[model samples]
Target: MSKLIDPIASVEDDTKSPVSVPSSPKDSPRTPIVALKHKHEDKPLSRSSSLLDMLHLKDVHIPTPPAVKFAPLNVPRHRRLQTAVVATWAFMIPICLTVFYGSLIFSKWLRPLAVAYAIWFVLFDRAWVHRGGRRQEWIRRSAFWKNFAAYYPITTVKEADLPADGKYVFGYHPHGIISMGAACTFATESTGFSELFPGVVCHLLTLDANFWIPFYRDILMGMGLSSVSKRSCRSILKMGRSICIVIGGASESLYAYPGTNDLTLKKRLGFIKIAIREGASLVPVYGFGENDIYELLPNEKGTMTYRFQKWFQSTFGFTVPLFHGRSVFTYNYGLMPYRRPVTVVVGSPIAVKQIDKPTDEEVQAVHKEYIEALQALWDKYKDKYAKDRKSELKLVD
Candidate 1:
């Protein structure tokens, strides 16, 4: 075997060099020199070192950091499957777009079908806008979604059983970066939503702009997502079907920092008004650990970043947040969300009486009750699920 060397000893040896000693104390310099000459003179200069040398920084010695640790090739099959499923869901939009365009371009037979679909989507396809989009039970019950949910291992906790006879409105809170919890829990049946509340079908509401995408829109509609517009919500409620809405929307996503539960719900009265008008019971669903999966950059109010985000939202009706998560091969950083357990708790329903036209006072009264119900839900489960939470829930505008 080769001889072993101590790193500390090697560093000491490399640093040590011969220094000339003076015979008299008066001839010696005030400060003793550790190394009078450059020690790396004999070694060939690296490209970075040469550039630094040209800048008269020959004496500078920058330490090199250790390389990032990546997942080994011998990872478990289940783990690989989980990563693959999550990656597919994460990049589904671009993948769908590419496939849609590529098929039309490469295959001559698909162009006619593509043109007809485009015309219908632009002119007459109001399923996403009216009647809660066509939901295919087969697609909603696909095994693929189970694998996707298993990646985050998302679970749904039903506090009380909602009767099928009652129409309901679920207000999903603290919109996480991409509302992963909301999507997995409501948009898909991966979390056993159907079994938990039998006969109570839920259509998750999203922005109207999302339906503009070609192939991606079909996937969303198939998953039982509809537009969040006033008309769509009213229409869905009229049909006696329940709907789930992420109350915070894009504004709340900006404040989606880990361990924080700040919600932008102070002035949100539209959902409350609609519920009152349609006699839909309001259910507050909180997804504990929703904001913990991704790390978001600080863009506090009054800052340039925050101002710009607000401006962009005003201009485009949506805002893009600067956030990051772990990658498939590494835990340090990428678009893939960290493997964090997200528990979505569906709370008790708050009853509302139907009104022809709810006044401001009536709306405010219902809004207060809704807020209290949501707060109670948070207080009840924060200790159990949010033990690592940095702060209590706050309803910020």
Candidate 2:
């Protein structure tokens, strides 16, 4: 081996150049000074060029966000009428509740009666849990849901005609903020759900807490929306009514970003268990443009916002999505969801065997088939319906 040189000595040798140094004190003589050659001195660069090179600069393509096109300022009379009908729908529930509560406050006698009614509704009036609530075809075919569905101009296409006698548990994907497509297709006759499958009445399941609201519960019940609870699901399935479940729930609403198909379903097996337990056929329904309707705040993983949202879910049993969309006049900025086409596609049904207590392996087997069906639905329509998507379907946890 060659003799080792001291690092300090080598450094000193590198800076051994001498130059004359002027003395600061006028009385002192000039002294000899030492300077070092910079390591990159051979390659001379201008100040700006050197700074740019240090940054390792490269051209970045920042794509322009797509512009939201609104209906013409001078809308036709029919379209204006349609808008009014939609607005009425948006305000109907709130108006009814306000009037009901106002009556309770204004009338002293009504307070005690109202309190009694509430107690009865909470304790004994579980009538909302039955298939009878869903058989109200008159309400399901009403003008309100008709107008609401017509606002989006929603449509449904079945891969194959479902058997009228078969019981189904439809696992609706993406949750889509409020699951507008689920409401339009399953809860109402706007998309002609009845005509598509003649004798099968599909009840859209929601959180049991929704039925706690006074007038709103009646409205939901009238539209045949029952609780998403296991008991409610089993009861409905046993009664021969199909159940449409928003599988992603509130957690998936966090992933409802525009142009992205981020679903929170990889680890969800509760629906599969229910399907197997009730012997309900598992139907995978995908709503294209459901996530694209509203633009939500980015809740990236490990960020405080996402952590807080997850905590909120654990505490409150639901999540709040920070989302915004267009307004009546403006093209892009309001509470109203942007007028995007939401196509609810119903895929082929996966048959499940009824088991009193399904084993882990049995549940997983059904879940795998359900996931594959959902993926197939996505793959089939992604190009046709989601041509402007930013990314392909991501099965997020």
Candidate 3:
């Protein structure tokens, strides 16, 4: 009986034993000393297998640096000089004029002289509408004007030879932030406008308000830039002289973004009418890369910023472009335009019939033909000139 009891007790103990033993040596949760000894014994073989596997696998690629194409040259001096020249025209001149006027207020020697000049400009100076202030020979051939155009390295390409005695009206497109092309090609003969179209003088027209600024007015008059007023256009055309009008005024400059060809000219018929009335031949001038010189901040329609700009244009008769370009120290930031080429292509002239008072239909007909000519210019040279364009020519009013 005692032996039977002992056998039952041993069975109970076996039932109570833990069933936590690992099924295989490799499946063990913890590394025992015995497992370590076996692993060390197989280490040499494992390393040999790894080496063979590596030899059989694909090769790992190690990239090399690209080779330099061209050697660098000294461009900093020219770039800095170009920036200074541009800045002087855009900002320094205006600021300096203000300072000069303030000095006149404090100086007894210059006060009377400044006052007399101001009075003369307001009451007697006929440069705004008449050709009295244009010293064509001196202004066109001046070294200062030459340097101004050379800063951008601007060039004019004449598609066809304009008739020497032909009275003409040049309609400049894209009204770049400042219409630098118009200034270079027409305002100054720096791009050799006289040599290109001999005996065909062009007077570049701008806003009348521009002529109101002190000292700056004299500069504008020297460059032969008159007002875009009806009287000015009529007077210049009646004299058998050509006039270059930046038709896409200040409002168009808002769309003047880099890598874009947008013109606010769909509804602009005033210039067309002027051409018809004066019997002046219409010439379309397109400046490639004019808008690419600077970048304008985005001002989408309906946004507050856009509305404010529109309001400002309506109130002040002029608008501003929130624009920027490269710098002297870096190609990243500043007001200096990038060293991009500006090729002003002067298209073939479109002859307009003389109408003392052109009807809307007549004006529209001329405008349509002008637009077609402008489009042809873009289509012909876009690939060659504007290969980096983000979009094609769009007449966005």
Candidate 4:
């Protein structure tokens, strides 16, 4: 079982005040110290007194309770705007649904338009499935994404330049809580990915289920995000554009505890097969401080919580993790992730030979090489970016 360290109690200390005694103790037999009496010490305890106080536990030192720090009213407008954009992004799915359904219900005149749109979405919407989504360069370069990236202050570090002519598959590691780093870096232009790696147009790939949401689907497509289905990947690579996949997927998200880099990669060979078959260069991207944005509840393996979460993922396509972060109003607890810096370091691409039908051994060989590159990347940046990590980078199945 994994142990969870208390972030609050780690910084607290117990102090003892020195008591002065008479100098005569050196020459004479030690005399028992008499308690100094105060007039109030003899007074009867009130009803409001705690049990410890009533029991005369006067020597006990009680630590002050932890208090939530609320956001100050004088916060800068730009910072507030950043928070608003982040909050909107966080709750975007529900917000879109509400807007869609609310418009149909409240605005009676728009019902026919809504029906038309729904029919078109159901029958003709292949944007999410093919050609790497309806990628709007202007939307990807919007100021909105810049603020979104500033929420975590996400940055992209390019170790080697990727050529424009080559097709590439970016394997994003450690699938941190929502893969926020991946979304900000690849889905949007928040991280200046285009400038960092000029000429390489990248699309962030997500689950097919995400495209099922009405308005949210359009928003995701507009930001250059596509479905992670094999067909979608092939279509994108065929067009000579690259795609970034959170290789760990939903299963890895269960291990997203703060300060840990436990990735589910040993048995993940699908991305490797895709890379080899499509003849795309494999790039390993690690997001440092990705898991430190939120604290997860104890759901270690063998526990019911862990079992249920695993069962849900196996039964459905995703699982819910019990996590908490600071709120918009207060800094103690809420759904808003902590404003931690996420530095996404893009490692040098490993060129793969195009194989029509790769054997298991060949796939494993490529997978091994990819793992080494990812590990080397971690080793290089762990000290500088992941100094606070609790454990070294681990590739857990």
lDDT for model 2: 0.80
User: Among these predicted structures, which one has the highest lDDT?
Assistant: 1
Alpha carbon deviation, residue 19, candidate 3 (Å): 57
Count clashing residue pairs per candidate: 0, 0, 0, 0
Q: Candidate 4 residues 1-397, lDDT tens each?
A: 2333323211112253323345577645878443333234753343344455545544545555456689889989998999998888888999989888887778888877877888898899998887777889888888988998898889989999899899899999879788888888898788888888889988999999988888899888998999999999988998889999999999888899999999999899998999999999999999998898888888989999999998999999988888988877887678988899999999999999999899999999999999999999999999999988899999789
Model 3 misplaced regions, further than 4 Å: 1-77
C-alpha root-mean-square deviation, candidate 2 = 11.7
Residues 1-397, model 3: lDDT tens digits? 1121111111113333332435566777675332111222332122223332334322333344333233134667665566667767768566858866886878898888888888998899887687724656686677766666777778899999999999999999889888888889998888999899999978899998888788788877887889899998998888888899999999999998888998999999899999999999999999998998887988998988899999999999999778877665556467767667788999999999999988888889999999999999889888988889999999998
Worst lDDT 10-window in candidate 3: 1-10
Reference-based TM-score, model 1: 0.83
Using lDDT as the yardstick, the better of models 1 and 3 is: 1
Q: Which candidate ranks first by TM-score, i.e. highest?
A: 4
Show where candidate 1 strays beyond 4 Å. Answer: 1-67
- Estimate the TM-score for candidate 4: 0.83
Task: Please give each candidate's TM-score.
Answer: 0.83, 0.79, 0.78, 0.83
lDDT per residue, candidate 1, 264-375, as tens digits?
9999999999999999999999999999989898898899999999999999999989998878888766889988989999999999999979999999999999999999
